[model samples]
Target chain A: MKDKQNLTGNLGALVKNFSNLHSIEPDSMLDLNTTTFLQKLVSKDVIDAGVRVKPKDYLKSLVLLEYFSGIIEGDYMACKNLAKISEKIRKIEDEEDTSVDPHERDSYLTLPVVIAEAALCANEKEDTYSDNASLKKIKVRYQNHDMKIDLHSPKSKKPEPYYDMIGQMVLDVTSKSVEHYLEKVSSRAELSSLIFTGHALDMIKSDSQKSKVKTALEKKDYFSASLEALKGIMKDITISVIDEYISNLEG
Target chain B: MGKKVVQGGELLFKEDIIIDEEAVRMQLTIPSRIPIFSIDEMQVFYNSHVFTLTKNSSKDAMIKVYTTEYGLNEEKSPKLQEDEYFKANTAEVNKLKEEFIKKAVIGMPDNCYDKSLEKQACLTLVEKINHAYDIAEHSYKAPPSKGLVPKLSDDSIFNTYIGDFERAMLLDGKVYRLETIQEYLSMFQKAIEPKFYKELEKKSVLMTPEEAFKELTDNRHKIHPWGFPFIRNKIWYNEKSFKIFLDGIYWIPKFASTSKNAEEKYRNAIERKIKTDAAEEGFGK
Candidate 1:
């Protein structure tokens, strides 16, 4: 919300920048509401960067941004519609010409979260919806929010229309558990312990291994590479920790 | 007299490619559209010897494109010869990269730590990858959230393919310069602090890669993977993008050379993120 505080000052400067960059009239470019909506949806860093990096995709970006805004604002219709669209997009029929790559669809699906994460990271004071607790609350709102879809209605035949509806409900219940499970599983000490075993430690300590880690670090895939290294480490430690922990618990 | 099959070169056009249905489809198919090469057959054509685009001095303003049913000669290729010649020029490219690093590049700024350049580089790299792979394109999509931070002690080769692909793009390019493709990509031995490169010139003490990595990872908690889907503005060579270039230079060992697997893992990770996202949205069922 503090990001909203700079809206008035930032808007004028941003509009000027956008207009200058795109060679468009300032008044013709974006209205106050549209600007505020996008600002609410993403960070100023994204906005400024978007304008500079891919000006051609600006219009399309606006449409996606608005859709995200609607979803975040607790619009069930938006959420339901996006879910349906996502499902349709994801469904790969053998003969379907329009069936996009899984990565592309995934990118579209994860855009909101990615933007939210970026905003959270880029400028914390300015980002509104990135706090984990806040996002959890939004998820709760989507789950508990009133919806008009009735499975018992006469026209609700074949259970097809209610498929996503059912999916929505299932996801709401399952995702919370998934989040909880992930949280419970991510014990720093335990994960570290798995990686610090004799062989794993030797791999980490070896000059070749350090060089390998250094290479991964350079590639910016450092995190996943690190995770992969952890995976390698856990090859020996797999399931052993659970028994050890269980024994500790029993003792 | 026109030659049999034109190989080892591209048809350079003097005019801008007009947008047609074919162009639009090609553009759409590209997933990530760049400034150059809009039309599939008109502006750019590659890898085939049966067709050629050559400079003809006829002033009719109509360019002739030659096509034939001639099968490609695998034993000896003009394109392969061209590639060999290009490969021989690697030293020149390395020199260019070195100069680009020495004079042009800057470290991550201290005050703002403005990462627009780095973010832009990622966007560019992602766009190039998407374009190359024929995947549906969404520019400025953030890298997977799970890989947001660089682990200090974590050493893994499974996720090093992206880096490998990037390195290939930079060093092996015959057409586009790496700096031109993603300006501000650092190719230096050290990841110096902002304006520290200039200081290094004076002091002659460069930070080691490990030290740089430590500095970058030390403040890793502050590092966020924020991005927008429509950043199209010119993000020229800057400190942040340079840092990314610095980060992208890794030697993949033979043991961890499963690039395909790494790429798959990368895709799978994105898919997982999408599921998590879909789960979070709840779809208002």
Candidate 2:
């Protein structure tokens, strides 16, 4: 019920991570909500060295980061769908031929989770998804939530029509789980990461940023690439959902 | 001077193709309405396909397609969102796969069956030289759930045959630096490897020694198999519309590549392969 409070637990971990990166104490950047968080990002000089999100429109980046990083929670499906619906709105704005199939959306939804799991684990350099803790956490989260999911032994699945009732359960679980997990993580250091989704590609400002993202993608450092792509979505497409949702949640 | 029987090269222009009642009833009939996938849908489709070597529906899987309207000499393709073209470059690679399967690809052997219960002579010991070993290997995976994921066949070799229906989406050949067809071939050899390999393997089987030599009569004809079906948007020199014969390869132009190449090849290859397969008189009787 205390949605923002629940999210802020994980948000606290975000602050500690930021503080550590800035070589400052944890007291700094007290409230990790969008607007004030932006201020902290600047004060810490975390702007250029770490997760170089655009200081200007980084709120969009934050929304994506928080939403996607939460994939480690049992409640991620709802968050992903909500983000996607928001993205669908953005697609319509850009006049894209969009078919956001509920079935196919899982792959799109799982991407950030996979990226987060890969990049945030302590032993990232050596771990594949099969062995990654983040992946295990998510699969466990889903199972604990009563969703039948088996990573090691997967069976073929059929596509079916979307149903609203199933959609509601997905949403309900996601909101509660995220709220619970966000508040539970003790510090910013405990936060898995949204680092990869925390950037924006404002090419109007520079081409080097684009090249940096491109080079990262070509090198298959998908964490870096995801951040860049999220930034691209925010910059080239629409950021209204991120901005509006966070603003409303913060209020 | 114009040449003899065209060797299924030179993407059959919209003007050159015509469909009638007979062509419609042929073995590889041009589909009345092919689903024009969005970027995301296409990405999933391309990545899931074993033929494309994209095993896991990984979003990063590379596919090739035609950028343009690389369909047969039809008046229209399924309508796209105005911005679908620009965004199409970033997603999964194939557009032709579904139609390829629908048109004329080989059947994958089904795997789901009850395990033969070897009557254990005793409950403990396993069977040594049993009839179970004689059972031909089959794909053990159960039939895929519908709507969960669109199914792709496991026939990898048959998948290679998809290439023989070679069509590239070259942006109407404007992006190329090719001075010769061979140059174009060399530059885009990777795109056509599937088709080339399929042809190399099948042609020997599909023809008699005498018939094979006779078939080279059209070797002088230039063919660029890449299809760009949507590119017909530019004011067409617009020839008479043609229908795919379904018994031979029909070239559609750069429908798009990587992403475009995958889709274009999927469409053109499926269409032509059906016609080619159906028309194989040698394989017939």
Candidate 3:
């Protein structure tokens, strides 16, 4: 009972602090956060006590408070406190003398765990997406069609232009094949001008593109000519596009 | 506020904790330009790796129990009495990882081709295509084309898979040759042009072997690099990032699988096993 009182007191303080910081009423948000967190906790089998104050409310309040406080004040301890509180709950659950599953225990790390932990607590439907513009500064988002989650660092001020170099074409502009280059430019222009006339090509457009394609084909640089043709039609030469194009051709 | 800790019988006052700013900044940050994967592929990814790392093994074990319980009789489910659940979970995780890795290949750029490394490149590309990745495997079994004639269907089929993408990019793993790379690139250039398809339409069959071979022979400089299609989905994690993700799984308790009530099921299974053993011992006595 004493432990439960302390848990409630801590939760209340956290709720008041978080609500004040966000400049919003605590009633509704607190309820939603508590419900979400509680459901997750129950599913995990972390709560062993028979009759109790909802431990998830305390966890949710602490998590929200730590998250906003860490970002806004840059006070790292606020985040650490969230972990400590979780540890405390685990300890409480463990004291019940029931056999515990090894997988149910909390796994702790020094640094990167903070981001994933914060992300786990993030509710997609909540106001965190819209109200907190600073949230974008962090990399935590539901990715892989919202099936997987990932987190990374924010962009720095450096002129680091990032690109997914894996499946993209690397166009070379510096080669000294002036005649070949001019031929490529002309062929590219010809291929690009043809309109998408449904899935199959129209006769006239097909004839024009094919002639340029054949001329390019006759030249030593068939690869560049093929790229121009695909890029012109697909508007982008990506693996997925190529795959889809092939699928259509096969069909 | 500082917290006091008794360490080795000496009381110590702890000050503010400093987060490793450098470590956090240096995380394997994938650029956003990477194309995201389809949902089906993402499902494959989660079923393979994430479930094990995130400690969803118990739930997975319960799922096996239920799958066996409902699909087959419970008599056949427990291969072993003591560690049956653990063994089942581990086996599934290992099998999935192996399956996924077989389909995974390192990201390849156009610049990966080198004349000096031709043999190695050819071997690696062929190995990946024939065994590891096998992107062309399904096309071999692809149904016949609608517009093309029966006699020329083989050519159309060849054009559909070999002549188009894999042959255009890989050329049966001989991408090291300058001519081969040029031909690969030219194949793509021609495929997009309206005239390329127009020519295809003119033929009763997709291609003659010589024609396909001629088309496959074009080369400019090189072809674009292709990573796995799921790379954009952030499914392709670097080694360090993979460890980080596994570490991250520890902190997110809510991700714990609760749907199956796995712990209860596990405990019940164990109890049943114990009771059965005791009954057998008593009968022997």
Candidate 4:
């Protein structure tokens, strides 16, 4: 009877602390809301306990089944805190105009966000890998298209770097003839034009323009003929025209 | 050996005199310009004594020399021997042999006889022939007449093929290239231009403003959802109603102008209405 009373008092204190932290007004909420609030309160307590614990020590403690089980109710809080961190990072990113130096900007922020989002969104959507094994394998559908890519990595892996590598690998594999893939992707959307990365655009343009130059060379007019065909490959234009020109050259 | 006298007017002859090797060598040294004879008819000659070098046997007529022992008795004289000097003249023979071999090398066939070269030439020739035949056949089939065929120039036929404006252009001495006009007719014979123009005129005369509004609504499906509001509002305006509501306005103006005794007043009014409506719709003012 004494122990039960002590547990009730601790729970009341946790609820009070959570309400204070989240700025939620005290009210009679539903069971799920109450559970969520308790989870956030417990997660804060764990963080408070780990204030002096090094990140490595904290991560080691998280690896233990006993420690992780004790924190099961606080997983939502950890996820929310991570989301808040990501939001803050995003706000900082938006303050600076990075359009002019998109590549450098993307390297700085997009890669990290892409990595975090891959894991976070996957977890949120119930698409996370089931195994806690070293190599965690998952598949994500890109752009709601038929293209599904498999990602595999160790559980101890940082999400950002892993996703960045995966993204680059996909780009490399598709780069050989990205125009063909882009055409298919755009057609599925019933679009006449598509905007892609500058590199992809340049590649397609050069490929098409080179052929046009070759044709001009065949016609014996090399002077006005341009080899610099793909200057603005990344810009939007009627894809059918490019496709027709390519087909005409091939014929 | 004693020299014997011949009868008057009879000539003394030597065995090798009739066939001189030197004369043969001279003739052989001259290169033949005729490709056919040099390639096909040249003969090879061999020297029996000098196995290393072959020469024309008919040339080199120097008589054989002999070494004699003067001490020998007349009765036992080494049975009149032929000369050993004929034993192959190695240096001269080698030189002649080299020259003959060089000439033979020069006489060898050229590389033009390869299969690919022959095939390419055959293809080119065939293409040229086919092109020439096509041109000739087309010319023969459609020879240009001295004057226009009366049947071809009939207004009814013109109206049946080309729309009113095109017909007028044809009759008004403005159109060029009869071949182009004829080709178009032949290509699209089923698409009678007069019938199309008449339908357009009927639509213009008969369609009501309400009906045009209904049509614009019906055609909304053909337009993008984002573009629908702009087009709908443009045609809905009262002042521009006639111009915006008319069906086939794009074709009617050209055909109406071609009508005989068409009044400029109606055209001007129509054009003004069209311009006003176009301006409202954000087109040309």
TM-score of each: 0.17, 0.18, 0.16, 0.14
Query: Model 1: what TM-score?
Result: 0.17
Better of 1 and 4 by lDDT: 1
Model 4, stretches more than 4 Å misplaced?
A1-87, A90-108, A127-179, A183-186, A189-251, B1-285
Q: RMSD of candidate 2 to the true fold?
A: 28.2
Question: Compared with the true structure, what per-residue lDDT tens digits does model 2 show for residues A1-251?
Answer: 35542343234323322322232322221111221233323223222222322222233333334434333332333334344544553443422222431112222223223223223331222232335675666444323323222212323121111111111112222223122232332222222222332233322134665676667645644344444444444344333434553355346
lDDT tens readout by residue for model 4, A113-159: 22232223334433223333311211111112212111122212122
For all candidates, the clash counts are: 14, 86, 17, 10
DockQ per model, Cα: 0.01, 0.01, 0.01, 0.01
Per-residue lDDT, model 2, residue A162, is 12
Question: Model 3, DockQ value?
Answer: 0.01
Residue-level lDDT of model 1, residues B111-208, one tens digit each, is: 21223433443343334333334433222222212231222221122122123222221100111112211111132313434454344334322343
RMSD of each candidate relative to the true structure: 30.8, 28.2, 34.9, 42.8
Which segments of model 1 are wrong by more than 4 Å? A1-70, A74-176, A179-251, B1-196, B201-210, B213-285
TM-score of 3: 0.16
At residue A228, candidate 3 shows an lDDT of 34
**Runs off by more than 4 Å, candidate 2:** A1-251, B1-261, B282-284
